[model samples]
Target: MDLLTYIFFAFLFIHIFKHIFNILTQKNHPPSPFAVPIIGHLHLLKPPLHKTLTSLSHHHGPVLHLKLGLRNALVLSSPSAIEEFFNTNDIVFANRPHALAGLHLGYNYTSLPWTPYGHHWRTLKRVTTINIFSSHSLSLSSRIRNEEIKHLVERLNVGFDESRAFKKLDLKSVFLELMFNVMMRFSTGKRFFEVGMDGDEKKRLIDTLTKILVPNTKMGLGDFFPLLTWFKFLKLDQKLIDLHKKRDDFLQSLINKHRNHDPSISTNDTTLMGTLLSLQKSEPEYYTEDILKGIISMMFTAGTDTTALTMEWAMSLLLNHPEVMAKAREEIDSKLQRKNILEESDLANLPYLTCIVNEALRLYPPGPLLVPHASSAECTVGGYRVPKGTIVMGNAWAIHRDPRLWEDPTEFRPERFAAGGEGHLGHGGYKFVPFGVGRRGCPGAGMAVRVAGLGLGALIQGFEWERVGGELVDMSEGSGSPTMSKLRPLEAMYRPRSL
Candidate 1:
């Protein structure tokens, strides 16, 4: 044969051999629905992503795979599958996916929540656990929580009548302000939402944060399709850049204020920023300005809204089931006999109150789909191979409400979490993971539980809560956000309870 003919035949032989090799070596992947060209399963995605994934899992299997544009995704709605992945392959899947929000808002993925699992992440976790979320630290900060809860109670009590008439109030705003104030004080020893604070300053701070946070909750097209990032028409990346600039400026101002302040000024060293600043003086190489700002950003972005929304959901559930509310209040009243005010210490003794919180969390977890985790190495999950860089997300909402897992799963029964209840598992337990599970689980779970417990318990103890206008508070969930929020903000009528 001539040289040209030989080259063509050789190329054909190589191609055929390669195709056969691929067939032989292909890994066993999980079940997936039909995917289209280029877009893959993107067309299948709908709003309220958790519910969509749950339906897909039901149609497919618990371990369902999808090609989200260029990315590979695994959505697990089964507790057994979740346990297998998170337990057996915890460290392999500890890294976070590279998204637009992590690039900008997460300080280019160096922040605690976005950074890959490594020495830096370990160091960040240690610092936060020791100085912020440790039991000892939470105990030391109890007074701040107590004071903030008191402020919230006082603010809600304003404009009350002698007859204790029920007054309409927006509990969403109340809970948001309370959480922000609590987290801000923990970080900076300042309360931005308190009454008589500079109105313009509060507005600017809140506006800037709201602008940044709302976008972070969304998953942009660029996150799934990197090529789409080249088109400026998308504008999500540009918006994130602008928002991060504003956020950086605000955080820098706070750091500078703390940095330049006199050390003798009332022992500010106890504050989170102050503690980090002190560490900066000693370990300047490790704790850079970006690190400080990143930690602070994590404090607000990770800690605030989830706890706030949990409170809102808990209250909405309580309003819909006044019997549950009465039971919770009765437990608090009987436990704290004549104390009137619900204290942080009082929360430990309130088992029924704890059950109520657990039930609320089960019904509507803050992160219905826990934060996305990425696999760093190839691994097997549920007998299927999960390639490196595959994004795995546990549908906590589905697991929490799985009919197979709980009796009357849809019902808001707090007693289901009492002794021998299915929902009574401890943290890191796959069957009941509101705060996530395994190595990368939230270190601040203790603090979150305390703040949420104290806030909800106080509200139940101090108020005669009722649905506004005889209509049930809407229990619908919001869409396009990472955290599950109420579609309609919760508003209720309340009067001071007569103990």
Candidate 2:
């Protein structure tokens, strides 16, 4: 045999021998089902990946060690597993996996979500915590949130010329428009879609966002096998390059406009982009134009779909169960005096409404697996040794629906949260991690709750809603790369209430 053939045989033999030795000797490893050579357990992965992982967790255990290509993943489902990782190993597990999305959309692993846990990530987190997501910041934007919801109500009213007659409305589109308007107005000081805009322009913008977001949200093959990037078979690499150009170009325009913006402009007119631009002056080295764009892009992509989809699911669930809807409306009407709207400040007093929002969050979390966290060093979880650089994914969907943790796990019982002192706070511990529980958990959660509460409360208070054709709204979860949304766009009949 040739020298090359001899070396290949020796390498293969050593690889198989190590596998056999690890299986026989490494009892500290977490239980895993059989994995194939080279590809490992990648073949077992299916769409709506959380469900497949949950099934594996169910059969083997909550803490599972699986080989996903060359990478090792620790699948966590139970709250204990979550705590052990997020608490004991929080720092070590704070790093993110080397995702393809991070390479392109996350500004080369520098965005808040994909940035490694270090000084750089710390700075981004500080900006979000102190400047963006602070209670003061949310209060500052309350006017924008209220105004956008009112605009939505107006558009909904205009759609139905007849006062009391139900009109067929594509709620998915309505919610999307409202969310996009609110998100854009709050972040960029402009609206991508509004009345009197060129129809073609609006369509083009929507199509571009979809083209970027739809694929970014889904886990690409390039993520699992980097070698596939060499071949032109998947085309993910080319697609990402094209998308990054379009996205960066668009975001750059926003930054440039704000750079030359008037300083005397009111804070109400000043947006997240403007605020960041102002900060850039003080910390030019830290807050580069690229960082500014990354923050806004992350805000737009992360904030828009998640907020809109959560509201859509909440409404769908309420339509499927009307008694819960009546209870929520009554709670609002009794305490609320703002005509047909619920103020952002008013969200706290209405406990039942908050419960419904929390329930929806638990049932259909925007991100089922949350984001994949990686270990910077070796760690022990659930009495098993996990290697360094393991990708840790917390299955929020499974944990939220785990029967052991929650009573009637599959049932939509918001009262359970109310019965305890939880009341949408997700209780005292990690029992409910709708927005996830960790240092890297979603920072926009507080703002998200306010948006959902005000938007949903206004709809319930001002209108009468029912499923079209007197049928129930479908609650089947749709497969998404980023968020598990409803399989179908929500369509419902609505009419103005005789308030």
Candidate 3:
């Protein structure tokens, strides 16, 4: 045979072999969207992504699989599907969704939220749970929180109008102040306004840092593409590095001050940074200084905004549904009438208040996506193959609003969590996973509940709240990574209630 004829035969054989291989691999996984070449589903996403995903869920089933460019994103929107994540295949979804925020908060992938499944993540989780988020730590911090709460009450009292019987106040700033002080005490053993900065500088610096940390714009192409991350188009990569450095410098300064304690002065049991430093001494390799800084940053990013956002939502919901608010207020006032202050133990008797908080969390989970989870190993869900390292996100918003799980899912009715109610917040209905589930669920759940419940309950007990401008509260949500807060700050008038 001629050499040209042999070459033609070889090319044809190779083409046929490639076709056969494609057909064989096609059977391994279920069908998905026709992902566009460069941008997959980027154009399909609408404003308020939660609503869009909810609509898509009805059409695509509970566990809809899709591609976000070469990246894979599985949108799980049902109780059963989420149950599979928490109970059946918990270990499979142990990793986190690799996003810009995770990397930023995790300090270049050192923290738990951004770390992949393995020794590093497991060690971090264990240390955090035992040393930082334990019940003992929370009880110890109660005195500190009470001190801050006292200041909050004093500020509100001074803000109230003595002549008019009611005065307008912006609850957002008040809550922000309270949370900022609390987090500062926990992080640096000092307050930003108290020790770090004076006059307007404190507020200005905090505001600027907050804006940089939580930018509204979509992350540059680097975050998603990974390959082009080194490119400097929007200066995103450089900006993050700069922000990290700034934050680290501030945190380290605080740490150094704590280290150089005066012999004459005594300190409280030890701050979060102190504990992290102690941990660093033992596990030098894993718990390095950078890792400690990342943990502090994560706590700040996760803690402050969400707690205040919940307060805004709960207050707004109570005002809108006067009956629920009235009932809750009555219960709190009656129960705590004798005591001058509200206690965490009082929370158990106030089931209705608990229900209301649950409902708020359901309607407006602080973290809409719940710190994305990644696949540790190759797995399949709802007949789709998910290879290892694929980023997975549970649509907490869609699951919370799933009609099949709750009656009138969109409505903010706290009755659903009452005794014999259809869907209790915890346990069975995995749909209302505001704190997420599985081993990596928010370790600060107990502290969050106590602080949120006590703070909000205090507001209800101490004052009668109403819209300041004689307008109804707008229930629209604001945009943010991790936390979906109120777009418009909740402004209200306060009138001290008669005992």
Candidate 4:
């Protein structure tokens, strides 16, 4: 009886000590709003999550903690705070949050974007950087980008009304197609999303891609509340399951096509898949077909959509601010090395155009929250304790529009990026992380910049664009994950520019 009493006392003492330790560690945690049971701040969240979080940051300081359902999210809105997270505590937050998309679309979390920081992920990152995103790799892909831009020019020219020379064209589709074609040509050596191919196949591919993408964009209930994952009688999970099947089938068909092809017969062998296939012959274990598919998946989803959205947003901003559009056109026309066709290299000559693109990125970053990083271990952010397993998000949207960091933050001022610009991409540390920062930042940033700049510059140089009507284009923010896009597709009148 005495021994039992002593054991009970020891157990009680240990529990008290642990509770005290937790209290001490949590003392410096960032401020949070009142949270309810189970759902926490999940109810406070609304669509266009970036905007919502930006508002929250304004109230709860630049860095704060929130209970997002069962998940704890540490949002960093200040530039210095973001720098500390990505710099000093980078490796700690290098891990990715477990989401349904990672399970379905990310190839069971083994893919580069979804995988936790480790040897395998490191290998994928190295392969992506060296083989795809390096300057040399991009230089090799220049021919493809140039060819696709010419196709865009031709598409725009033919679609417009001949008599008036003004047509209300859906530039959203045009830019999307341009990006899709560029990505496909780069990845699979095929041109998809262009006019006059197989109607059914086109519809199938577009529909399938849209379905797959829409789910990822949604802030699903299961993500914040894991218990809800099993109770998905709501059909979200079913839809995802269906999407996974379709995507698998589609990608498998492409893989089989490459697999069955006779290497000698294929004249165009410079495709990314083809290159990977060749690598597979030597290192089959490391460079498996699944890894190739994962790489393709990342490239196709990331490469196509982000550039398309940037171009769309840039075009929309220009349309609303006609003076900016006119100024950009003037810059393009005056200094363009090739008046007939603007090459990717020509983007360097147009400083104003670069400013326009940068400003557009500032206004609407493709990935506003920088892809939901997670803390692998406890760390300090903004001098506060960030517990292990907490979600760490850099609010690029907030930082971009922070009145402290930018003058006329809401305005479309491309000149802000000029000599006296308040926020310079290079100088602003984490203040201007549109493409993100540190180790887990987008690896495809180099290629994405080249594509967006060239695409935007060429469109400006090649066409005379006018807003459809006197009314301003509706710049409503849309739903997207890993990218923020304009809700309404940009429609505008266009005519070919005279040489």
By TM-score, the candidates rank as 1, 2, 4, 3
List candidate 1 segments past 4 Å from native. Answer: 1-25, 197-208, 230-236, 262-267, 426-429, 479-499
Give me the overall lDDT of model 1: 0.80
lDDT (Cα) of model 4: 0.75
Answer with 3 or 4, whichever has the higher TM-score: 4
* Two-way lDDT contest, 1 vs 3, winner: 1
lDDT of 2 at 383: 77
lDDT, residue 352, candidate 2: 86
Ranking by lDDT: 1, 2, 4, 3
Q: Which candidate has the highest lDDT of all?
A: 1
Segments of candidate 4 deviating more than 4 angstroms: 1-25, 159-164, 194-205, 213-219, 227-236, 262-267, 425-428, 479-499
TM-score of model 4 relative to the true fold? 0.86
Cα lDDT of model 1 by residue, 1-499, tens digit:
9754764565456546644663598789899998765567999989788999999999999899998866789998988888888888889989999888889888889999999999999999999989998889999999999999988776667656555666666666567678888887888888867576553675576556666553445676788777557657657588788888888997888888787783422238889988999999999998999999999988888788788888888888888898988888778878876455788999889988888888888889989998899999888766798888998999999998889888888999888778877776633457788888888888788888888899998888777777876778778898322222221211232444322
Give per-residue CA lDDT, model 2, range 218-238, as digits (tens): 556677666556656448677
Q: lDDT (CA) for every model shown? A: 0.80, 0.77, 0.68, 0.75
The residue pairs that clash in candidate 1, if any, are none
Q: For every model shown, what is its TM-score relative to the native structure?
A: 0.88, 0.88, 0.85, 0.86
Give one digit per residue, the lDDT tens place, for model 3 in 156-213: 5553344535555555655666777788777666664553234377567557656544
Better of 2 and 3 by lDDT: 2
lDDT, residue 29, candidate 1: 87
Please give the distance, in angstroms, between residue 381's alpha carbon in candidate 4 and its true position after superposition.
3.2
